[model samples]
Target: MLQARTICATVALAGVVLAAGAVPAAAATAAPARAAVTCPTGWGSGAKSDSDSTATPLSDIRTGRHDCFDRMVVDVPGAASGDLGYSVRYVDRLYQDGSGRHIPVAGGAVLEVRVAAPSYAPETGEPTYPARAGHPLPGVNLTGYRTFRDARFAGSFEGETQVGLGVRARLPFRVLELPGRLVVDVAHTWTAGG
Candidate 1:
């Protein structure tokens, strides 16, 4: 009985040590640098529409403003069924503020554009393109927005990829691919007021 008790105690101690060592080393790394940007009051609180599509109610939209830009959260319906690949990123030269300052967004105006293909996997709930390999299909262009640039696959948090854009204004945007929807959350930047 004495020997068995000692063995159990030793096993428990080893388990604790192993668990402590299993933590990821990257957790100690510094966070990415962020900038301070402002959003208009109630700016992110309304429905928006794309020229090619109708307006969508702003339910899933979230407010985000960074050093040189503001953002919108595009919530996708969990039960949505479609053959579209979607992504979001910042765009440059899409719109200009009052001071003519081009908005510095992460992706462009066509942030998070996804094209659905026939081979999309239903089980995993992720789009797949054979010709593109690890990337999604090309994105669409916004009419009357000359500064709104193109879109491309970019790195993101949690090992996922997002579509990036280069825009001219610090606009908040959301894209709903299921019903072919896109919403731009426009707010007057603080700089535009003064």
Candidate 2:
């Protein structure tokens, strides 16, 4: 009787150990995987979108061709209750007077980017278009398509500004705005390949 009881207890302990070993395997199968977002052709990488009190963060973004141009839009949040105002549009040229050089426009596709926000003035209730800082704006390029020539910010209109990229054909593209910056990536796809 004593020997039989000892054997039963050992079998129970073994079963417990086997059960413990199965947990991690089950967890590995149960966890969900994250999906990766990538850009299509004529787009760059690292695109994402978000917002804050001072600015609405828009980056790594792209839009399909509508009419004659591709449109990229970004929203700028107001810092205070009435402290936001701006606009955006496309232009034919972007001039740099200090360097005395003109950035050549791309050939195939025309890109138009715009931003609209309110002006921060203590006295005026009317909205005014503020000048964009002459700093470098975001850029987009074309890949896998020879028709694409180059991309650059053309200029601004009223309050809207434009960045133009030359492209040969209108291809599928994607845009992303990650934290602190934005990106646009372009890739080619086929029906057979995943």
Candidate 3:
């Protein structure tokens, strides 16, 4: 009886040890298997449309950086509702919106950006996004971005504006509508694991 009790205790103790060891081993194996950060989907190589219309003209165009992607923002006053639409896609070459002149870009890929709303005043046909002759025009300084090379105004006409984006490589991109602005984000990679 004494030997039987000792054997049973030893078996039970061994089972407990095995259970404890398994918990850590399972955790370790699952560590690398952790779910990676998922980027927003349904943003593909095509025109993304937001039918909601806005008369508010674009006030500014800018770019910022994030861990996963680079951001471009088109600012328009009083556009809190997503009444604006856009067409953002990769292209073989860029052209001036009104003149149809070929634009030379700095990178391997070109992103033609078209905004549905105008960037000018209707009454006097005044310039909202003023252009500089013989200069590169208003563009963001993409000093440290992994994918972005350059961005500039292609042109604006017929109540639409165009901005051309030059990138190191053709990359995944997304667009959004925020208060007073339309945003474009180009991803650093297909999956931003961080």
Candidate 4:
């Protein structure tokens, strides 16, 4: 009788343990689901411009790649945020600012970036950002970038500097003016990471 009781106890303990585990497993299966990923909206492909101008000449050009977009930054020394002006728009073709010569860019679409600051120092008339002779910007490589195909310095003339950004297509883009910098970002696609 004692052996039979022990066997019954073991069976009873296993049943209780299984019931407890089943409750927690069911609760875990009923947990809430996660939200889906959504891409940013409202940034368009139209022309973006600001009328503000700065006497501080643009000194440098740089670029970066991100998860959803590619970026280009123009450095303007001694200029405050929102003090610099820019006109960023998709164009059929890119051309030199002063010479009006056609600039051949490599991509399906071209972004004409016009900053309202010279690339030269006004005091000494020396180039702060030197000319590129239609070549890609120094140190900017677009080999693995998702949005950018090529970038060239179009020209700097009459207190304005222009750059040609060759992109994969006419994608949405935005311009941001930070302290002493003008930034342009081109989205990879209509949906983020698509």
Please give the CA lDDT of all the candidate structures.
0.37, 0.40, 0.77, 0.89
Query: TM-score of model 4 relative to the true fold?
Result: 0.79
**Ordered list by TM-score, greatest first:** 4, 3, 2, 1
**Per-prediction TM-score to the true structure, in the order listed:** 0.28, 0.35, 0.73, 0.79
Best by lDDT: 4
Q: Return the TM-score for candidate 3, rounded to 2 decimals.
A: 0.73
lDDT of 2 at 92: 49
Candidate 4 displacement at residue 173 in angstroms: 0.3
- Put down candidate 1 lDDT per residue, 20-131, tens digits, no spaces: 8765544555466655444334334222323231112112223344333343333333323332343333333323222333333333243433222222344454444222
Candidate 3, 58-171: lDDT as tens digits: 877888987777888888887775778788889889888667788777787888888887778756678777753222447668898877887867766878888888877777
> How well is each residue in 50-166 modelled by candidate 4, as lDDT tens digits?
999987999889999876688999999899999999999999999887688999999999999999999898888898886675878778889999999999988788899999999
6-88: candidate 2 lDDT, tens digit per residue: 99999999999999999988999999885553432333322222332233322222333332223343333323433323222
Top TM-score model: 4
- Model 2's lDDT to the true fold? 0.40
Off by over 4 Å in 4: 1-38
Off by over 4 Å in 1: 1-41, 44-139, 155-161, 172-194
